[model samples]
Target chain A: MTTLTREFTKGLWDEIPLFRIVLGLCPALAVTTTMENGLGMGVAATFVLVCSNGLISLLRNVIPSEVRVACYIVIIAAFVVAVEMLMKAYFFSLSESLGIFIPLIVVNCIILGRAEAFARKNGVLASLADGLGMGLGFTLALTVLATLRELLGAGTLGLVFGERVLLAQPFGFFQQAPGAFVALGILLGLMNVLSKSGK
Target chain B: MKSYLQMVLSLSLIAVLSGLALGGLNELTFEQIQINILKFKKIPAVADIYEILTGELSSEERMAVEEGLLSEKRYVDLGLNEPSLFFVVRKDGAPFAVALEDYGQGFAGNLGVMVGFEIETGNLVGIGITTMSETPGVGTRVKEKAFVTQFMGMSKDAVLKVKKDGGEVDALSGATVSSRAVAQAMDNARAFYTEHREAILDAVNETPGGSS
Candidate 1:
């Protein structure tokens, strides 16, 4: 049980998908322009990740070694399509805002990465914990990154809830595509500095 | 030899099951998704045009929207389902502005845009950009109100070319190609409106999905 707990918690910080391990940078950069966008993306990816990881782990022994990759991809893709439908049905506005990135979640490295590295070798419960932990970590990282960008870039935060109002002066430059990169770079650099100093 | 066959059988089984699962889920969610899309994307876009046309949309118009009677959407059945889709906004049983979505060639690739125009008045109502692949700051800024606002209230006979091209419209500073692409899309939509004005008006006045 301790080992299972360790497996899950490690994904939160030690093996964080974005800053520490540096997996799935495409949606990380594209959708972090707004807090809502980043959160929506993180949630969607999490859904696909958790579902795929669980299914792959359950079928790990049954799946042929030679054709496991193809099998995993099929399973992952079906879950992604399911996630897409649920999001479309319930959170239609969010689905629209995320746009092509929703379908693009199927190609996100984190889902496939966990499926290969952890899920295939782990038990179902362990895989589920790992997927949840990694997903939460991704969501946390995105929400933190988006808070910085939205607050600094646009001057007003809490626009995600739709009760928008101006609070402070904005840099405006942070709201652009270049701004997204610069902010991400700074965050990455900060994480590096903190880890190195701690070590 | 046995392992190879097992690999093939297992993979094929997974693929077949995935297909069935997806097919079943799609059936369950298709209607809700369609309704959500109309409520979220299409209605909001149509409402924006409606407000722009009449300055303010009435409570009746809002109710019409809720009742699914405020607008009509048409995908031009050109046999192959071309990128030509349109939304017709009606008031008092008459079509005010018909919004058309069309594509035009730009420097990057195809530039997709939507333009709403007053049918009877021959006045351009508004332009809202939908899908675009232009450069981020330069070309994509065509979506910004500064560039898009230039298209409002222009007449049908008025030349749609940019200022350098000897017309009223001003090209986006560094993204002239993107601006020109939007202009060309508007031109195409206008041409389509001219050709299919009668059919579109009839469709807007009819119930939803009752028109071609």
Candidate 2:
């Protein structure tokens, strides 16, 4: 595989953010109560991640090492704020639902982690691919978890998609914080088993 | 010393560039963002007031009323450079009440309240919280029906201060600052309504389509 494809695909499976790397659990747990919220957050984060990654990679040589973290934060915050303004302008309801988490994206460890561990050392194109891959991976994990929780907790699918009621009664536990932890734990265990069996 | 200079120079350059980009983006989206906030936040709050004044409305009717309210924007120039925006609430194809927003300092920052006032009687129709960053369970209770219903039907000249300040308004338990913020916003609203009553009524009446 080419370097770009390798970097991109790795985020899909090998380093699938929340599940494998265990980063960005805050938003993952907070916004995954519903499928729509998870998806909305995922798209917003992807925008920020891609933009920040590309910019950081392009400026890696110019940014002094001693102040790289600060520079990265400035870039990430600008993108996050831009996302916020755009979301409010166009996707008002979704922006309302996501609330502070959209602004809090500036602090999401996933973006900073990638900037330090990958983008700072990689070329701009490679960093862009990596960001897109990681972002999509994060989106995938959030969607899967949110689908499970929403199905079990609400007995229906997303309201955005015209909620389809599946179960007559749903377990309400999966909609709360404790449930998020338990569900994440089980998913992690499941991933472990799958990885083991694959080998 | 050379490396230090580079660090400062680079950091400052990045910060300045980021600020410029954000400022420009904010300018570009400022109008749209305002419309969105009015649609999503202020409109809903006014709808809450509508529900309180006139009985409940079906979802379709509520949507119609919200749409009408958006088009009903009237400006009152309080000598504040730019004319302040307020909305008219129509009843039975006539101007019934006017809704305007005001803000007060809260625990976190500014808490916005949209208040409705009856045109003829000069009585407060109701109040709905437009925006607040108060504590979720405690300060946020100010948005609850129990807390807000207290302001319903209050006369225009009534003292809009909390009981803590020797006024009739009751403060929310465990959230004095937020409760005070609501009272303060109401005071500001009352002042605006009373001062610009003629201008507001004239603006609403002059408009062609008051029916929705």
Candidate 3:
């Protein structure tokens, strides 16, 4: 794969934001009770991540090294607010579903981590791909987690493609805080097993 | 000295540019956002409350009120943290019912509650949970009909408290924070109205299109 494609694909698995890097667990644990919610949160974070990443990378040189982190936060927060307004106006339902976490995206370490580690050094195009990759990775991990939780917790998996209810009556333990912890533990174990086999 | 000047100038320049961008975006969407919140979240609660407040009004009048048969929606600022919105449905030039937006500090975070109230009497007609960060299935169950419905027709004269601390409001099992947060919201709704009853009424009544 070309280096550019590699930047985009790495987030799919290798440096997956939630699992591989273990970043942005707060929203993952909080909003992933349902597949739809997980997707909404994931996509919202991705929008902020991509836009903020591109902006920071473009302005990286203009920002002083000592105040780079503060500049990143301001830029990220502005984008988050803009995203929040747009969501509230147009995607009202999704905005309601995501709730406080939309604003909390300002605090999501994934966005900041990218700005500090990758965006600051890379060109805008490369940083955009990285942001898109990592954001999608986070989204994938969340959706997988939410799918399990919803199937188990609510006894129905309402996939957003016309909300086809996959299972009418599934396990209920996968829906709460304790359920989130247990589910994460199992998924991490599964990841460990898959990685061991590949090795 | 040169490095410090660079740091100060660069960060401020970034802040100013980003602020402009954010401001432009906010200008585009903030109006629509307000409309969305009003039409979806707050209006439903008002309609529900209007049902109970209906005395001698015809079904036509009831439907009109439910369909936001009002001329204007008033936003009130107690000048504290942020302004809370109030919707007063007037009939025949008299205030029929009032919906007060209330905020409470939840265990997880802040809670946004819109409460429908009877104007003449302080009875709670209905409620809408606008925003909450309570844990799903556990604390969030407070938003369900089983819990919020219990407050309907509740006399605002009484203090809103959870059963755990010796009030009539039943606390959700293992979700004390969520329950208390709701109670706090109710307390805010009642206190704000009681303290500023005249001003709230005056503001809405003073506005045009509210005459009988």
How much does each candidate deviate from the true structure in C-alpha RMSD? 3.3, 5.0, 4.7
CA lDDT of A113 in candidate 2? Answer: 96
Q: A41, model 3: CA deviation in Å?
A: 2.0
Over B1-212, each residue of candidate 2 has an lDDT whose tens digit, in order, gives 99999999999999999899999999999889888877899989998898886788999999988887787777766678777778887788778899999999999889999999999898999999999877655798999988988888888778888898988799988998999999999889888888888888877765533321
Chain A TM-scores for all candidates read 0.94, 0.96, 0.94
Q: Model 3 over residues B1-212: C-alpha lDDT tens digits?
A: 99999999988988898889888888998878877776677666566555545553576775677566344567565676755457876557677777777878897788877787777886777676877877766888987778877887888776688888888888888888888888888788888888988777767765633322
Fnat (0 to 1) per candidate: 0.91, 0.91, 0.86
Query: What is the C-alpha lDDT profile of model 1 across A1-199, one tens digit per residue?
Result: 9988987898788988898988888888878877888898998888888899999999999998888988988898888888889999999878866878898888889999999999999999999999999998898888878878878776656655554345666777777778888988899999999989999
- Each prediction's DockQ against the real complex: 0.86, 0.70, 0.73
**What is the lDDT, from 0 to 100, of the residue B103 in candidate 3?**
79
> Each prediction's TM-score against the native?
0.86, 0.78, 0.79
Q: Compared to the true structure, candidate 2 yields what TM-score?
A: 0.78
What would the DockQ be for model 1? Answer: 0.86
Question: Which rank order by TM-score, best down to worst?
Answer: 1, 3, 2
Local accuracy of candidate 2 as per-residue lDDT tens digits, A14-55? 999999899998999988888999999999999999999999
Error of 3 at B202 (Å): 4.1
Evaluated with TM-score, which candidate comes out highest?
Answer: 1
Query: What clash pairs does model 3 have?
Result: A152-A171, A155-A170, B92-B212, B93-B212
- lDDT per residue (tens digit) for residues B1-212 in model 1: 99999999999999999899889999999988877766665556566656665665578876566455334776555444543456777667666778877778877778866778787786788877665667656798887868876777888887877777887778888988888888888888888788877766655554555333
